[model samples]
Target: MNGDWLLRGRDGRLSVYLPSGDAVLCRAELGPGGPWEASPRKVGGDQKLRPGPAVGQGADGYAHLVSWRPTKPGEAGLVHSTHFRPRLAALDWVPIGHPDKSGDRTGAPAVAVDGEGRAHVFVRNKGGGLSMVAQKEKGGWEPWRDLKGSDVQEDLAAVTGESGRVELYAAVPGGLLYWRQGEPGKPPVLEEAVETPVRPGTLRALATSADRTTLFYTDDSGDLCAWRPGGKPVALLASAGPGPVSAVRCELDGHDCTLLAQRSSSGRVAFAAYPTEQEAAGAWWAESGPQLPSDARVSLATDEDGRVVAATLSPSTGQLLLTRRKDEPGLALEAWREG
Candidate 1:
């Protein structure tokens, strides 16, 4: 139930991936307003995985996924799989191994595809720092390399800017750690860290403009905040609940906007929309549909027509629930549909 679970493929069809029991399952949309497949497709074969697999789609329209696979007590590793085309089954999960050969504990992983269609995976390493592996020019993976930082928490955030350069962020004790590529396809360099009180597991990133990304997270008091590089954090909504918020930039009423969905403390899905990067203007949160499990994660993505598609698991039945933004205006949503 990671924030990256829902994605739109190149063909304009939407796909939702979630951990069902011990295996991951995928249900795809037939088309806009079309029904989802009756049966969920099993991804990565019979491999068992930790819940909340991270998924990212490249410019080529392929969906790439990474998840934690528990091995021995200290030998757990991350595995990766890809759907090369829309509505097609994904390849089997391949073990990417741990960053430390000495069997250090690994935290959750985050994946992002660069401008050149290479997928980059980042995770908290053994020493509470960050390590990464990226797809090589010819489709092979480069060895895991350390992208130094310390006291890092789980819930790492990674995003590829409109310029194709990939940037990463992690919550630390007193502030946040940052990294970015000098240019597309280049390795990321550690940038100046921002001093702010970011709640662990609530960090999320969205590219609001070309070459720039805005970070969203709940502050120490559980209030939502937004910040961009070289700028002070801007406080947004209050009581955004716990965990991360799913965000996507799309056009609303002919105006560019950013849509966010989060499971409120009341266990209901709430949504908010505002002009992209205009947080100071203000935003209002509206509860949507039915109540989900307090711990259930929500995801947001845009369909081919730029309509916001939202997904979450049913609290009672554990079924995949999906809804989309109505074409009329604002953040109005269609009825909740089960997959």
Candidate 2:
């Protein structure tokens, strides 16, 4: 492996990863003229403010991000165990000020493009709760508006469909959010929340098919659940192991839907995959995966035609051990044998 990654844009240009190494923050340019990754522009304000989550460009093209600026003053006196309580505001991140104000970006961040070629960036307000900012027409940005919420996560999706039928999906602690615009240049008609036991922050991964016919997300139990509305969320599996499972990658393979998961431990890396389909209900899934390594592992992505591409993190050296399934040969085109 050359150890290089390029976000292929509609223009076929490649922007090298900033400062090299693994990127903690990244976004796809999406659409023509291609994707671009640059250093985070300094949002002048409090020195105590910390970067919350990186902005993610929608698979369609809009970028999303959020930073935390405190309003309370002084360093964080609370501990991680108490993070859920009080909902501490160490800093106040005001994205749009009086043009004379100062602060950082705040709350959970989300990004989506409207039918009118505008980028909608959302952030939670510490004061008003769910506050967001929109970048109207690829220009600077719009004033902060109150988006309803007590807290939020960074995972979101958008679609610019026919006749200005633009839709946005956000992962909230309550459940999935749907924002749609039937007209032009206006806020979407917010829908009521759908009830679910799992919280948004507890979500492991979320993905939607190109047609929006299939939408899925993983829970703390490691079971990949999905529903296209009017349908039930069927559980995919019981999870590869216990605790927080991450580095997930999945795709719809020919009649079968596939998922790849990693389990990181002491010094050896391990990986596994799960397969399910509409025709499969009583069919087994855990039986589909192979015995993994001894230490840590993480998935990269999947290829078209339903095959998965994953990189297992080398436990001792942290080398990304890559693997994928093939058609004809031995171990399903995804077996790795260290010689």
Candidate 3:
């Protein structure tokens, strides 16, 4: 599993997947306040398939979901489904692709919706290679294309670049390799891997603008690092735990800022904001937010109004907590409040 269960839809509604005895796919959605509502119906699958689902919402107000499913008892692959109509009464789960090898487990699929409202699915095949498929404008998916690299170390980080171009990144043997699609309907071209000073762990990325993106990763030394397109790798903070870092681009006090959150080995989570790209280049990391337990993973997304929202999963209490940072004057880091 890629450890992505909670996601924010295009309309700012948050949806989460939970385990249920009666169904394989049980989803819950919550808005700004009040209670959580169950999706119209439960989506079911084979008994052998694990619930490693990844979801993405397109600008057209359609939500696409992909999850690991067994082709048979001993073989595993990915299944694609979509929710388009106002009500989610029935979903069409299609058999998209199968693993390269039998009994091989595939990671959770990564999805990106382009400016044209086309959905792209990137999955790490069981052979440790990366492959992709896209949704056609009219209906159905195109053929699966193997982007070809047998050494991908983790789930891919992808974002829609400026002009509807797609960019994908993975942590490989010596460094990170990136691929950018030439244009719509053109094959993606792979670039040379850029070596890093420290061995990278899982990668997390977000597009700050059509032309700019910020990449974050946990290093072998458990420190948090940041990198941008064609920029030098910089360590943002030391002693960060092995947990994944969540980041997003938003307006902080009416200024563009990139907010980052990471957990520490001491069982506390800290958040910081870099008001400008130049400040982030200087590693000007200021601690923010109340300390949170280290066991949970954080997922961050920005709303239409530029509000930075965070969802954290607490393993000890089995609670999913939602928090948002307060917009205040000055450049100092501020505390986050529960909704």
Candidate 4:
């Protein structure tokens, strides 16, 4: 299924997670509606799965993963593949394998699940070292450890009320780290990850506020911060320039959506709309027009309530997009894009 976020959950339910083994537990479920009238439920299939990218879900519903597999797949080639032997997973809908035994080779693996549900995995080890592993209440998974702290760069958050705390935001080109998790084998209280500095700006994506006490993020020269510790991470709207973001969502009602498609830095493809918990008295920062299609970088699209669209991934040239505010528009398109 070669998935990359294809999310949809507000009940109309939709999900896609298949990066094709090496470890990619493609789980699908399209029941209530949407994503084509629904009819997909792979339920969770990972023979031993080993694809590493990034995945998370907490508040205790459980579902965590980090995909990365290129020992051979389209020639991203990794013959020794960082030396193999790093497969950490803790699934939901059902799947959890933790006896701990990884050696990470930096293929991008960043996972999260804390505030007491356990499971907090990180990686950047091809011998370079940044490795980490947690998950100990159910007992098991705590071996590949080695995070001497200095230059770590992980990302995971869902601090919903902080029961055991789930927040692992790391940055270390210059420095920033905060691995706070209140209850999980007694260790996770580092601090120094509250970004915004060093120019070209880059906090990129972070969202949690269905009562997670406000924590919305987005920054990479486009500005959009908003935090919860002593207050000060708010910029909200075109602060620098350059485009092609297309991904930063957290709205089943938690509100906070960001999607951009190339053309700035001087070219011109500016689309704006920001507001993810910052409206108690004057909430007014609206934007939802028509922007995206000038060298689209994955044709920005969103659904589940952030409904917006623009697609064309390969139609002569392709530049996709999709957003249906109930007008019921989908499939049956000859152009305006989708291939």
- Judged by TM-score relative to the true structure, which candidate is superior, 2 or 3? 3
User: Which scores greater on lDDT, model 2 or model 4?
Assistant: 4
Number of clashes in model 1? Answer: 0
Off-target runs (Cα >4 Å) in candidate 2 are 1-49, 58-106, 113-118, 127-129, 149-177, 181-186, 204-223, 230-232, 241-253, 256-307, 312-321, 327-339
Off by over 4 Å in 3: 1-6, 18-31, 38-48, 84-92, 99-103, 197-201, 279-295, 315-317, 330-339
lDDT of 4: 0.40
The better candidate by TM-score, 3 or 4, is: 3
Model 4 Cα RMSD, Å?
Answer: 17.9
lDDT of each: 0.83, 0.39, 0.63, 0.40
Candidate 2's TM-score? 0.54
Over 4 Å off, model 4: 1-37, 45-131, 134-142, 146-155, 158-167, 170-232, 235-339
Give the Cα RMSD of candidate 1: 1.8
Q: For this target, which candidate reaches the highest lDDT against the unseen true structure? A: 1
Per-residue C-alpha lDDT of model 1 across residues 25-128, encoded as one tens digit per residue: 88888875568888778887888887668888788888888988878775677889988754787899998878885474478788888989998999888888
Q: Estimate the TM-score of every prediction.
A: 0.94, 0.54, 0.82, 0.28
Model 2, 201-302: lDDT tens digits are 323332334333333455645565554444556765544443223332344344344343435233333344444335154423222233445543343444
Worst 10 residues of 3 by lDDT: 18-27
* lDDT (tens digit, per residue) of candidate 4 on 1-339: 111234444343434333432444333333423333222223234333444345554544444554443333432311101101112122322322221232323445555556565656665444443556666676655555665465444332323234545555444554345555455565455644565542221323343343244443455455544455445566545432332233344232344533333334443333443444443322222233344444333333354444554332222232333333344332212223121
Question: Candidate 3 at 61: error in angstroms?
Answer: 4.7
List all candidate RMSDs to the true structure.
1.8, 10.2, 3.8, 17.9
